[model samples]
Target: MASESDGQGRLPTGIPWSSPTVRVVLLSTVLAPLGVPLISPALPTIRDVLALTDAQASLLVDRVGRRRVLIPSLFAFSLLGAAVALGPPYWVVLAVRVVQGTAAAALFITTVTLIGDTFEGVRRNTVLGVNVAVLSAGAAVYPLVGGALAAVSWNAPFAVYLVGLPVAVLAYRVLPEPAGERERRSVSYLRNVVSALPAREAAALYGSAFLIELLLFGAALTAVPFLLDGTYDLPAVLIGAVVTLTEVASVVTSALNGGFSRRVSNHGIIAAGFGIVGGGLVAAWWAPTLGVLVAATAALGAGWGTVLPSLDAGVSEGVETRFRAGALSFRNSTTFLGRALGPWLFTTLVVGRGYRPLLLVAGGCALAFVPVVLLLGRRG
Candidate 1:
C-alpha cells in the first residue's frame, strides 16, 4: 500500500548510482529501438539469404503489434532472437519478427510508463529527454554493430537481440507493478484510460507522435536505404554510418531538449520540428550527391529529435499517474504502427510515381502537422 510518491522518493540520487529503477528504465529504452535499426544495416543481406523481395525484407521492420501481453512478449522476444540467430528458414524468421515487433512495443510503453510513475515536474521532463536520448544513442550504435557483424554473417545481427535477455532480467527485478486504486483487466483499464484522457490535448500529442514516426521511421529509415542502395550501391557498413549521422543529430537535439523547453513553447517547438523535417525531406529527395543526403538526414534528425521529447514531456505531464502506462502504451503503439505502415505505404507510392514524388508527399505530411500542433498550443 505504497503511494506513487513513496516510490519516487525512494529513487537514488548520486555517487555510484544504485537505483535499479533508473538502471532498468534506461536499459529498457535501449532495447526499444533495437528491433528496427539493429538489423537495418544488414537488411539487403537478409533479403538475399532468405530469397526475400524488398517488400518481404521491409516487413521484418514493420510488423510491430499488440500491447496487453507485454511481459510474455519480452520473453518471446528473447526466444525469437535466438531462433532468428540460429538462421531459421525465411517463413520462421518472419513469424519470429512479428512477435519481436510486439515485444518492442511492450518494452517501449513499459519504459515510458515507469518514468511517468517514478518522477514528476522538471525531473520527469529531464528523464524523458534522457530516455529519448538513450533511444537515439541506441539507434546510432546498433546499425554500426549490425553492419560489422553482417561482415561476418547476416545471423550475427540477430545475435545482438540477445541483449534483450539481460534487459528482461533487470526489468523483472526493478520495475514495480502499476498500483491503481483498483485492479482492472487490460481492456477495461485501456478503455478507462482513454475515457479519462483530455481529448483535445491527447489528440494533438498523440497525433504529433504518430506523424513524427510517419516521417522518421516511415520516410527516412524506410526510404533512405533503397535510395542509397539503388543509387549509390553503398555497402551496409557505410549505410550504417550515414544512418548513424542522422541518429547523432537526434542525440544532440534530445540531450539539449530540456533547455529548449525552457526557451520555447511546446507547440512552437513541435511546429518548427515539422517544418524542418519537411524541408529536410525535400532536400533529401532532390539531393544529387551523398554529401547532400547526409546534410538532409542531419536536418531530418534535428527536426524529429525536437518533436519526440516535446511530445513525451507534454503527454507525461498531462496524464494522470494511474492512466500513464495505458496512455503511453497507446502512444508507443502509434509509433510502431507508423513504422509498420511507412515502408508499405511509401513503397507502393514509389512504384507508381517514384522516390522524388514520394519524398514530396512525406515532407508535405510532416508540414501538415504544424498548424494542428499550433492550435493545440493555443488551446493550452
Candidate 2:
C-alpha cells in the first residue's frame, strides 16, 4: 500500500493542497458548487427552449429526495439507480438534478466526515473551513466559466463535470477511507443517526434556510445578472465575474473561519457568522456601489461557510459509527432542499414584485438569525 505521502515527501497533514485527502475535498467542493451556479444562469433559456412552464421546469430541477440519496449514500449501491432518471427529456433533466444535487451534498458532507476523522487539532477545522471556502470560490468562478460555455450552448456547465469527475476518481483512489468510529447498533442506520442529532432545532435550520436561500440563491443567479445587464448595460462576462466577487470574500472568510473555530467555541463562531451575514444584508439594502454590493455578498458567503462546518461537527458529535455517513448525508439532503428551492422562490418574487422587496426579504431572513444563535441546541 502507498504511504500517505506524495513524491515530494511531505507529512500528510502538513501539506494540504498536495495531500490526497485535501485533493478529494477540493474536487468535491468544486463539483458541488460548480453544478449549481454554472447551470443556473442558463435555466430560463432551457425552460423556454423546452417549452416548459415555470412550475414544471422548477419541479424537474428540485427533486428533494434525490438530494438526500446523493449526500448520504446510505444505501451504498443506489447511485447508479438515481443517475438513471436524471438523463434528459426536460422532466428527466429535472429528475437528474436530484442526482446532481445529492451528489454535490455527498461530496460536501462526506468531505466533512473525512476531514473530521482524518485530521485533528487546529488542522481539522482549518481543513474543513478551507474546503468550504474553496467550495464557495468554485461556485463563484464557475459562473463565468459556465456562462462563457453557455454563450455557445445552454448545457455548457454540465460539461465542466468532466474536469471534476476525473479528479473525484483520482481522489477516491488515493485518500484513505474514513474509518467509522461509533459503536454499531441494532436500530436502522437512518434512525440511529437521527437520534444523534437535535431534530427540532435542525428542522428550524431547515425552515430558515428554505426561506433565506430560496430568496438569496435564487435572486443572485436569476435576477442579479439581468438586473445589472438591463439596468447598467454591463457585459455578460463582467456580470459573470461580478457574481463571483462574493466568493472572493468567502475565500478570505473561510481561512478566517479555520482560525476562529479553533480559538472560539462552535456556538461562538456560528453566532458571529450570522451576525456578520445579517449585517452584510442590511448594508446591501443601502448598497449604492458595486464595491458595497460585493461586500455584502462576502459577508453572506463567509457566514454560510461558518454555519455548515459547525453544524456538521456539532450534530455529528454523538452519532454512532454505523450512522456517521448516514447522518451527514441527512444534513446534506436538507441543504440541497434549500438549494433547489432557493432560485425559484426568488424567481417567483421577481415575477410578483421586484428586486427591492427581494433584497429586503433576503437580508431580513439573514438578520432574523441574530437572535437564533442562543436557540440552536446549545451543544457547546
Candidate 3:
C-alpha cells in the first residue's frame, strides 16, 4: 500500500492554509456548524411565525458518507437549504432541515477523513486544530448574517445554504479521493468498524466527543439565545452578535489547540475542558449582567476549542489506520446524536422550570464527568 505521504510532498511542519486540499476541506467542514447557528438567531421569529411553543421550537434547529458522497452531500445541503426558504408548511420545513443535517454530516465525516488521509502525526493534529478553528469561524459569522437577514424575513437566512453549491464545485475540482483509499477496503464492513473500536481509548474518545457536543448544544447553543431573548429582550441581531463572541473565543482557542496538545495529555485536556465548560455554565446560571453572560459564553467556547481538536486528533491517531474510516464515522455519529439529544433533553427539563435551572443542571452534569474521565484515564 502506498503511504499517505507518498504523492503529497507537502511540508510537514507548517500549517498548510494555502493548499487547495486543506482549503476545500476547511470550507466544507465549516458548513457543519453553519447549518444550525445560521438559523439560531432567527429561531424566536420562526417560532412566533409558526406558532411553535418553546419545546416545538427546539425541534427545528438541527451527515453521510466519505469520499463517495462528498459532492452529492454538498448538493443536497444546497438544495435543502434553499427549499426551506420557500415558506413551506412547518412540517415540510422541519423535514428539509432534517435532510440538510444529513448533508452536513457527510461534509463533516468526509473532511475529517480527508485530513487523516492527507496528513500524519503532529501535522495531522495541527490541521485538525485549524479545521476546528475554521469550523468555529463559520459558527461565528453566520449568526450575525442570519440575524440581519432574519430581521428582513424569517426565510432570508436559508439562502446562506446556497453557499454550499460553490464550495461543492471547488471541492469537485480540487479534492480527489486519496490514493489507495479505495484499494484498502476490507470486505466485511461491520467487522472493520468493530475491530477499530475494540480499544478502550477509541470508546473513550467517542464518549468525550458525545459529551462535549451534548453540553455545547444543550447549554450554550440552544439555551443561550432563548435566555437572551426572553429575559433580556435582545433582538435577533444582538443575540447573533453575542453568539458570535462565543464562537470567536472558540476560534482563538482552537487555533492554539496544537500547542495545548503538545503540553497536555488528551485525557487531561478533555477533563479540564469539561471542567471549564461546567464552570462556564455555573457562571451563566449566576450571570446578573449581559457582560457576565458574554464572559461565560467565552468560557464555553474556550472549553470547546480546547477539547474538540484533541478528540478529533485522538480518533485519527489512536485508531488503527485500516479501520480508521469506520472509527471516524462512528465518532461523527456520536456527535450528531449528542447534538440532537441535547436540545430535546434541555427542552424536556426546561418545560416548566426555566433556562437558568437547566443551565445549573447541565453544569452539574459536566462537572460530574470529570472524575469519571480521570478514573478511566488511570485504568487506561
Candidate 4:
C-alpha cells in the first residue's frame, strides 16, 4: 500500500477545511441545529394540538443505542417523524422527537469526529472554532423561521428535517474520509469502539458543555415566546423578533468569542463560560421586565459562545488522530444526551413550579458541574 504520507509524514490534500471542505461539512452542522430552534417558537401550538405536557415538549440531544447507530441515527429519526406525522397523532409526533434527538446526537458527534480525524495543527483549532460558530449560527436563525412558519401551521417545522438527506449525500461526495493513523490502529470493529472512549470522554464533555449551554439557552428560547406572549402580552411576531434579537446577540458573541479564544487559555475561557451561563440563568429567572429578559438572553448567548469553542478545541486537541471521528461521535452522543435530558428535566419541573423555578433549577445545575469540571482537570 502506498503511504499517504510521502514517507515524510504529510497529507496529500493539504488538510480538512482546506478550501471547499468547510462548506460541505458545515451543511450537516447547519442542518442538525436548525430543527429545534425553528420548532421552539412554535412549541406551544404543538403542545396544545398534541395535548402534551410541558416536560414532553422541549428540545434536547441523546444517543442512538440501536441500528448502525452512528451517522444514520442523525437522519433516521427525522424520517420516522415524517412517517408518523402522516397519522397526525400527538403521541407519535412526540415519540418522533425522541428519535430525532438520537439522530441529532449522531450528526453532531459524527461531524466533530470527522473533523478531529481530518486535520492537525492550526487547522484543527481553527476548524473547531468555526464549527462551534456555525452551529450557533444555525441555532440563532432557526427560531425566527420556526415562529414565522408557525403563522402558517404547527407541523411546518418538521420540514427542516427533509433537508438532511441531501446534506448527507453532500457529505458522501465532498467530505474527505482521511485515514492517516486510524487505518493502521485496528482491524477490528469492537476494538475501534473501545479505542474511542478516553478521547471521546473529553470530546463528550466539550460537547456536553455545548449542549448544556444549548439546554439552558434552549429552555430560555423555547420559553421566551410563551413568556412574552403569555406574561407580557406581546404578539407572536414580536416574540419572534425578540428571539431574533437573542440570536443576533448569540451569533455576535460566537464570532467575538472565537477570536478571543485564540488569544486565551482554553481552561480559563471554559470556566468563565460556565460561570456566565450559570449567572445568566439566575438573572433571567429573576428578571422583572422584558428588557431584563432580553439582557439575560444576550448574557446566556455570550456565555455559550465562550464555553463551546473552548470545549470544542479542548476535545479536538485531546483526541487521538485516527479515532477522532468515532470519539467525536461518542462526544456528540453525550452532548445530545445532556440536551435531551435538559428539556425533559426543565419542562417536567416547570410544570409544577413555573418558569422562574425552572431557571433557578438550571442555574443550580450549571453551578453544580463546576466542581465536577475542576475535579476532571485535577485528575491524571
Best by lDDT: 3
Q: How many Å off is the CA of 141 in candidate 3?
A: 1.6
Give per-residue lDDT, candidate 3, residue 343. 76
- Candidate 4 to truth, TM: 0.69
TM-scores of the candidates are 0.82, 0.72, 0.82, 0.69
- Per-model C-alpha lDDT, please? 0.75, 0.60, 0.80, 0.62
Clashes of each: 0, 6, 4, 8
Cα deviation of 285, candidate 2, in Å: 1.7
List clashing residue pairs in candidate 1: none
Off by over 4 Å in 2: 1-19, 40-102, 150-159, 181-187, 199-215, 218-238, 288-291, 346-354, 375-380
lDDT string for model 1 (201-317, tens) is 788888888788878876677788778888889996677577778888888887676667666866687788899899999898899898998788788888988888777767766
lDDT of 2 at 211: 41
lDDT of 3 by residue, 242-343 (tens): 777778888887787667766776777778888999999999999999899879988998898888887877777766655677778889888878987887
- Model 4 segments beyond 4 Å from truth? 1-18, 39-104, 146-170, 180-219, 222-236, 286-288, 347-375, 378-380
The local lDDT score (0 to 100) that residue 66 gets in candidate 4 is 15
What TM-score would you give candidate 2 relative to the actual structure?
A: 0.72
